[model samples]
Target: MKAEGGTTCGNSTKNDSTEEVKNQYHYPLTLPNYTKAEGGTTWKDKEQVFDKAPKRIMANTRPAAELLLHLGLGDKIVGVGADFGAPDKTVEKEYSKLNILSDKYVGKEVVLGTNPDLVFGRGGLFDNSDGRVGTVDTLNEMGINTYVLESSVTGGTYTSIYKDIKNLGKIFNVQDKAENFIKELKGRQEFISTKLSSIKEEKTFAYLHITDPKELNVEPAHDETFFNDVFKMVKLDNVFKNETGEVSVETLINANPDVLIIPDWNTYDGSSANKMKEALYANPKLSSMKAIKNKQIYAVDFNYMFGYSYNAIDGMDILAKEMYPDLFK
Candidate 1:
């Protein structure tokens, strides 16, 4: 027998006479690929286990939307939750073509209207909200299958991304596409790693969120967050390594790292990058820090640094090159 793609299976290839060809040809035919393997089995029957790609998929968060686009499944997406940012001009154009609106769904009516076969989301997007849009129970009650990407779970690393991609591929019946995407992503990560590995001097950095003049939050580098991974790759010491979750402004002032990294600062809001720096300078306690005194503060794209998508690698590259220009050069 042969699979639909014209690959031989079962008893092997046969000539026009329907006789087994044997190993007579210069190139022997390899056994058909099977999903499962057993011990001491000469050959197993090949089966196309899954079919019928998901017709309508609702992405509950920005990272999921980005991942789907990276996986070449953006066209399959029927709906996307709000908060997906299209910063790059090319990506913005593509997003416009897809008609992905960054609007929140207050009820299931819009999602149900799409008639989605599957719903994809990170746990927080559903959990942190009022449980109205993409909750598992709600979707299941509507006869829609829901899949949590799992990478949204805290402590997710590169390995988690690979596993999530594979799982998604299996669900969507696009394993080959998923494998190819993983290969490309992994290759890029490896290249970044190789570029950073030779650095002789590493900088000590701190990630600070300037909520206001009186309030600030600090994320430690060893907290298993995406930012943590990026800092680790560039061999920077995160001053907040001892703490998990957020920290007070006093803690940041005390740590006073070599490089101060801020996110979400360059917006229309009052906390623009320049304003944050000004605030830092005005604060006598923080102004004494080496980083502040030397003007070593840097701002990153808030969405990219906070998000765990292909862009996280981009963020890593930017941080690595910025922190150690000589090595990257």
Candidate 2:
């Protein structure tokens, strides 16, 4: 498990946005060409409406900040919190300039301190059970709007990401920027589609995470997440797509996937990928697996695989090249 170079692909797109996918609305939505408002409901099934674009916003996660910055709404973001992963290099400089409200999750008091009109982030940020950054309803009651990423609410898919981009564009009145970004993503997808079209067989891969170099967790394919959709885009099959929650090592070895897809948590803990891979390699039970024997394991950026952001396209591109390097070259 050696560190690999990052992709040279600049903001290319993924699988087509033709599918009819509904976006998760943490913020209010206005129907097109309607002068009067009829109000709207959120993914949480709560009522919310917006009369104008949010000013003095707060990005609650790294991907949220990156999306806002890419939309040219960086100035609108008053502060950021809960940034657990590294920001992509494209937005790294601008992201570094923003006021960090907190390194981990922000408390409700800290959120109110920013005096933001809206708090934008994935769905996880709204959990108020622990009372850190109150629930979406409480935030709305406090006169602040909230937006959850659609992908977070309704499984991770390219169509969902596209819908989110379009929705965010309309919400922030940055339709042009959002449309351009979507188009770029589509272009990249088309490039991948063309390059890999010659291949007829789909390779099987397992998206996994390892903590303590012993316990391995597999992401289910049928789950509402990005792995399955991205795997399909690259013409790969998920071995654990049918199973749910913590499949045993024996189950993984029994399934015997063609490739092992691990999230590179190196940023959080140095040499984590190497440690995990080393343990897997040293294990006697896993040696018979094709991925282990052929050394077909890939450690990808955690943000690219886990979050419901536009950056998933980068993750898709990385997978495409990794499995089919000859075609890419």
Q: Number of the top candidate by TM-score? A: 2
Per-residue lDDT tens digits for candidate 2, residues 190-277, read 9888999998888988877755556666666456556577767788888777776667777878889999988787766565677777
**Which 10 consecutive positions of candidate 2 have the poorest summed lDDT?**
32-41
**Candidate 1 error regions (>4 Å):** 1-52, 86-92, 103-110, 200-202, 211-214, 219-224, 241-246, 265-275
Clashes by residue pair, model 2: 13-185, 221-241
Q: Write the per-residue lDDT of candidate 1 for residues 225-306, one digit (tens) a residue.
A: 5456566666776777668566777777777688988775443243466677678767776877888898887777665665
* Residue 29 displacement in candidate 1 (angstroms): 28
How much lDDT does candidate 1 score? 0.61
Lowest lDDT block of 10, candidate 1: 32-41
Query: In candidate 2, how many Å is residue 160 off?
Result: 1.1
